[model samples]
Target: MKTFIIRSFIGIFFGGFLAVLITNLTIIFGGLEIIDGPLFVKNSIGSILCGWFFTVSPLYFEKRNLKLSQQTILHFLTVTSLYLILALTIGWIPFTIINILLTLVISIFVYTIFWVAFYLYFKNQARKLNDCLKRL
Candidate 1:
């Protein structure tokens, strides 16, 4: 799909930009040196893929004629699990219970907020369309 590809490219671009920014910020704030290593390349690829995944996964539920609550639950379950897996694999989060739990909580909260915002935005658009149609 053209829309999917275009969105994926945009997502990866911004995600990579943020990844570089955050890496530099950590080097500055955390007093860490930038390492030009294979891991860096790996992380760069992982970050791009993660961004693409997040952009597309939620739309799986969005394309269906599901209730808002259903979409929220499905998106949370799918996105959070994938996010945790991707993050842990990329060494973004340590493989420990505390880190895992925190990642899970934070991922859920963030995606929930995202879903709610989009849901409300589309609902408002629908309302405006309906109002227009009534005058036809």
Candidate 2:
């Protein structure tokens, strides 16, 4: 359980960092404005929370024999709802639509990358453990 929490935190942190990095990169390339600091903070937090939800939801759904489509829909709804609530609580800005959309896209991309990285890491670890056990 502790390992799971640590892994989840790492996933969320990296996912949030990736989104911020991409956003800043785009800004540096003159693609978008830097926007307000508080808004960006909200976005980063939302991305991290969404990343956690996205990482775990599918596993829970799968354990319950849920369809992929159902899982996808639930994931979308869950992330969207959380984003909206956080944004609202943080105060609405005129660029709410753009903020929400950009955050959602970046969060999804970062979360996907984190998921793949974690999956590969665990797979390799499991293989090493199996090999060690066989040798023992």
Candidate 3:
């Protein structure tokens, strides 16, 4: 319980931080400037919630009964849905077909990048562990 609380707080902090960072980046690069206070606050809160969900959703992977593929798919869907909804609500993305598709494509690309990076990292870790076991 204590661990969970700590993890949740960490997740929220990262979420809020990332939200602000991204917003600033968008303002700098995306241009069309001028974000009012209310909009910023709303977007920040939405992003924090999204981040919290992203963090805790991985707990689903701990279900050893589910195959890795199943867990990955479930996590992807859960996180993507929350992100898309928040993106739309916060007006970070407009409600047009092309915009929606583009957002999804970008999201999928980013997710794939992280997924592959983690996969390679863990695969390397497992190989190192196996090598150590063999030596022992």
For this target, which candidate reaches the highest TM-score against the unseen true structure? 3
lDDT of 2 by residue, 1-136 (tens): 6655765887698769876896688688976755767767777776677677656544544546776557656765676567567656656434577877877787688757865786699799999999999999
How do the residues 14-117 of candidate 3 rate in per-residue lDDT, one tens digit apiece?
98999889889988998946987887788789878877887888876788999989998998999888888888888878999999999889889998999899
In lDDT terms, how accurate is model 3?
Answer: 0.86
Worst 10-residue stretch by lDDT in candidate 3? Answer: 1-10
* lDDT (Cα atoms) of all candidates against the true structure: 0.80, 0.69, 0.86
Which segments of candidate 3 are over 4 A away from where they belong? 1-4, 19-35
Off by over 4 Å in 1: 23-34, 65-67
Per-residue lDDT of candidate 1, residues 11-116 (tens digit): 7997798778877887899997767678777787888887887787667664668886777777678777877888898898999999999887887777668767
Better candidate by TM-score, 1 or 3: 3
Candidate 2, lDDT over the whole model: 0.69
Structural similarity to truth (TM-score) of each candidate:
0.74, 0.45, 0.82
Comparing candidate 1 with candidate 3, which one achieves the higher lDDT?
A: 3
